[model samples]
Target: MSLNDASCTFESMTSPTTLKTSTEPPLVSAVHWTRAQWLLLMVVCTVLALDGLDVSMVGVALPSIGQELNLGTDSLQWIVSAYVLGYGSLLLLGGRLADLLGRRRIFLIALSVFAAASLLGGLVDDPAILIATRFIKGLAAAFTAPTGFSIITTNFAEGRERNKALSIFTTFGASGFSLGLVVGGLMTSLSWRWTFLVSVPIAVVVVFLGMKFIPKDKPSAENSGHDIWGAVTLALGMLGLVYTLVSAPEQGWGSVATIAGFAVSIAVLAAFAVIENKVKHPLIRFSILKEGWVARANLSAVGLFGSYLSFQFIVTMYLQSVLGWTPLGMALALLPAGLLVATSAPFADRLIEKFGATQLILTGLTALGLGYVLFLRVGTTPNYVLDILPSVVLLGIGFALAFPSINVQATAGIKDSEQGLAAGLIQTSTQVGAALVLAVTTALVSGHGQAAGTVSAQAMLEQYRPGLILSAAVAIAALLVAAAPSRRRVRT
Candidate 1:
């Protein structure tokens, strides 16, 4: 059934007695939202989907771009890493800007930048210029993503309505990535540039619709002072940290460069913390992390995205390098996880409501860990149905359940004024945490390959297994974190 149909069914099933009886207008589930409300949600979701779409599509086209540009592996790697570095660094600032400025204003401006960057990225010939454009796009996305998230949280009421809205929003984001793989494969066959160009028009339409439908509000007068020092330190600190993590594998984890990078990053961040404490108006209120659920939810997001990225890296390597599968075939093989996440939009919020976000998270992590464990049994020639499909299905189910719920819990009790701050924190955790895990996983795979030089296909398969094991271990650790008792903490 269509989304509207499912929503209609849900609306019909609700009892009138259960509805709010006060004079304040009744809170409506997303299924019963008016056209304008739905349109507003779509506008924000489209921006997020564009972010996901751009990332995945560019990933698929990397080989073609390398071939055409005559770039080495190191140079080509920067094409992706530049984007991540920009994105992971400024997410905190982006979210705070949304709250300080109007969400509508910040969102529209950033999206415009994103569109402009996409256009430049597609047209550019110089590899350095192309990488710069990717970084610009990532910087734009860092703003749009959290602002879009806060837009929903502020516009929708806090219970079922917001839950459903977030589920649908995240589904669109996940689906965009899933579908982009297929789209990228097709576009790359014609030209690698198409992947970059494709997002431009969609982003333009979104910007236009946002202007018309998204309501505007003025910034707070009570908090007019700018925290220039805080912003600088935080941004610099995050940039240094993410850059260090992204480069550590290639630089050697114990190298002087990596050590100095970490030291500088940590010291800068410590300065940021002191500034936040002393400033009349801080960039981020450090107290938000004191809320145990909020902290746990952020950690969960880190684990969720971290493991998934690492797993995807390993799977992509295995499918293409070992099995000699086409890009399109690999895309199809992984399509089920994306499909499951997309289809779960209808019931994900309902599941959150019934089981509670905490329960669903624990269960989802269990499934995710098991999926990684199952993949450990992979051989040189394995049955897709027996060895892969089951793990794929479990991973799909795990993500479909956990991702939305983690989002819900993160922002649940947060006041609307700081909603953008809360949103940025969780998203920042996801990106930065994923970078760290993927770097370590890459190091493991690379180290193993060097140890067993000129290995057979079977031995090559063995090289990637350690990364797979790391992914599973991360999931299990996260599961333990979620399952821990938090009665006092939740109350606090």
Candidate 2:
């Protein structure tokens, strides 16, 4: 089906609570539409931004969180693990629920949940409670993020207009991560709790604006009950996988706990595959994996976001410990990179128009790899402009180039019926991949039997240097994935 044809269906809509239908004109037809539509667009964009911001912002706050809670290194790791585990595991389930129920309904409810979760996190005294709240917040985010993207894909026109909106949405999300670092640093200075509390007001505003401006969701008749067992298995399997990876660095990879996690995850995921094959309305349709561009983009998603974040993790340590930059200074130094992403993104849409997804992804990966390679040259001496700024710029450009193109390609051919699930899969790949890669990165940086954060600056840098090369290698691997397209045309 063509984009215009997809637009034709949205002309008829239902009330938010009802399964009824209507005959309004296709919202997609109005590229230069009303102010209300623009408001809706912006609100959803902010919602997506909040999701991305939560990930990177909380990362910067980890040290502060550890200090305030008197948490151990393993506990600090759980701060990240809890959120990634929740987000990655429930993504497909969340996305499927949106499709089966209503996007607008799920979106609003999730926002409220996020606000509540943030409040819980702020008020919590125990590290376990804080981690639980973070997990719940991330669970809420898993629902909101992909649903927001699916909303954009359905509401916006296809071609240039849709692509433009996507880029703008992604730019906000990208900016949110970088901005979160800055905001997190400042907030953590005041109190680490603020990192959690701050999101509440933003969520409140998004919910209000969203309810006012958001369009009603019309359900598909075919979108009935979703796969129950798949959700169960996927959740367990993903949590197991994330836990295994997170624990492997501290405990030996061959340790009983680590081995158990891996065994459980692999077995459960294999069972999930069988259940998916047997079930009707499976959370993920097996055939979707056969889609060439979808497969390619998802493969790179693993590499792109995973390696990018792991690189940031390394840079954060180097800046704070080795160079002795303050948290605020670390954030400020990365600010230019954030701005570069915003500046480059508007043009990235046009680049996709010219070079297409395949070429853009490969080029972006190449640049991203080079940026990592540049980081390998960083000395103990701190020269932000000379050493870090150039690499940051390249990474910013690389992400801008890579993100939208891959999104457009992966989602372009998918039907509206399954777009939510498809979006979920993309995000799932990203966070899950990041979680796995982060474990490896930390393991490499920490070295064998070395306690996290118990090393001298010189020793830490020595271990970290090899990890940077690993990040570069991951980027190169993504480039290779994009380079070798299957013989079949991308599903559309």
Candidate 3:
């Protein structure tokens, strides 16, 4: 069959069996889907879901993890920061490898590694080992997450079909992250280790299904010419920058270690830019960076994600520490945000198609900024209905609108071969932004703490307000950036 005919047949075959028309020929009749496709999709969804859960779940279990591990406030930050460091640093490399190698192979291998790391983390008794395992898991996640997108990109032809599939994938990812809080809360009530252990079964199922159904792509001949030096420089530079941010709270900004780290990051990143400009096959092409929409979308992501991460971290702490809510209660309280994120995202695609990404992104930022302002007005008195819920709903709506629009805009007009690279850049910016904001906000709040007896609940709340307010201002800045004429349209 011709390519178009083959695709048409495949589309009709993949459609719901119940919808088959009576006039359709017997051979063209929709065959019952084998166990493979269902299992494979489930497995991939599980992997994405676990990623979502792990990111949010830790917040719920942080208090317990700290108590059991005998960790201080700074160490608590390290636990999360270490993971982001590993994940963010390797994201681009992961995407590159998926394109260079094969998405199926990389995904399965990464999933296996992630599973093993999760197991080690769950079983480890020592705090140091736990942190190390978390880092390993993050590294594995860096490999797996982008590959999920790559798989969809390769398997589904672009247009309405690809858009719908991607939408479902993105929605599941969002849901996974939000639901993870609920799962983590429940699991932590039993034992903090359960949070890590939960991944074991899901990973097994995903790996098994993935092997059965995920299509294998032949290695690209062009991939052999990858710029290894560019990859190394980029990773190291990001690592240095993230380390400096995460460590600055404890080491002090002026300390030699922090200063050295920042200096090295700047120098290394500059070197990376220079190398990319000269190299024939750079890890990230300089040409792509010159694209206005791609650059602005990524820059906006840095600010948008940074604010969101910082807000969530602070709110989780406030609910548990100040309000004295259990993990379960806190999870329940945050459910609206999670549901909103999942429900609103599909509609965002339609909005983008009608009004374009620029307007949707701007509106999202406005909603997010307003949400933060509303959250800042929240007092020590626990009034969840009036103070917290409104902000949660608004923030949910904002992120739901923002995330997919940014993804679509960033990838629009890019060549098929470059899609993986663009996807990696987007994911890396998000995690790095989270790490940056968390570090800065933590340092600011920790530094503002009152004398031991004077540290009332309200005083603690007041200290956190500055971080939230700063986050709001950052969102406003993102709105401004999104509104700029340079980013007003995706260049074809």
Query: Residue pairs in steric clash, candidate 1?
Result: none
Model 2, span 88-150: residue lDDT tens: 878877877787788999999999999999898888888889889888988898899888988
What tens digits encode model 3's per-residue C-alpha lDDT throughout 291-392? Answer: 536777787888788998888878887887777777899889989988988786456545554445566677788899999999987877868889999999
Could you tell me how far off, in angstroms, the CA of residue 326 lies in candidate 2 after the best superposition?
0.6
How do the residues 1-492 of candidate 1 rate in per-residue lDDT, one tens digit apiece?
112111222222122123222343433444579899999999999888888888788888999999999998888878888889999999999999899988999999999999999999999899999999989988999999999999999899877888899999988887787777888888888899999998889999998999999988677453578999999999999999999998998999999999999999999999999999999888898888865368888989899989988998899889887787888888888888888988998888888766567777887888999999999998888798899999999999999888888888888767788889999999999999889999999899988884535657777798898999999999999987877655213222
User: Candidate 2: lDDT over CA atoms?
Assistant: 0.78
Sliding window of 10 residues with minimal summed lDDT for model 3: 1-10
The top-ranked prediction according to lDDT is 1
Candidate 3 residue pairs that clash: 52-177
Worst 10 residues of 1 by lDDT: 1-10
Q: What is the lDDT of residue 76 in candidate 1?
A: 83
The TM-score measured for candidate 1 stands at 0.93
Descending-TM-score candidate ranking: 1, 2, 3
- lDDT of candidates 1 onward, in order: 0.85, 0.78, 0.76
- The clash count for each model shown is 0, 1, 1
Q: Pick the candidate with the highest TM-score.
A: 1
Using all chains and alpha carbons, the TM-scores for the candidates as numbered come to 0.93, 0.90, 0.89
Model 2 spans with C-alpha error above 4 angstroms: 1-31, 448-456, 489-492
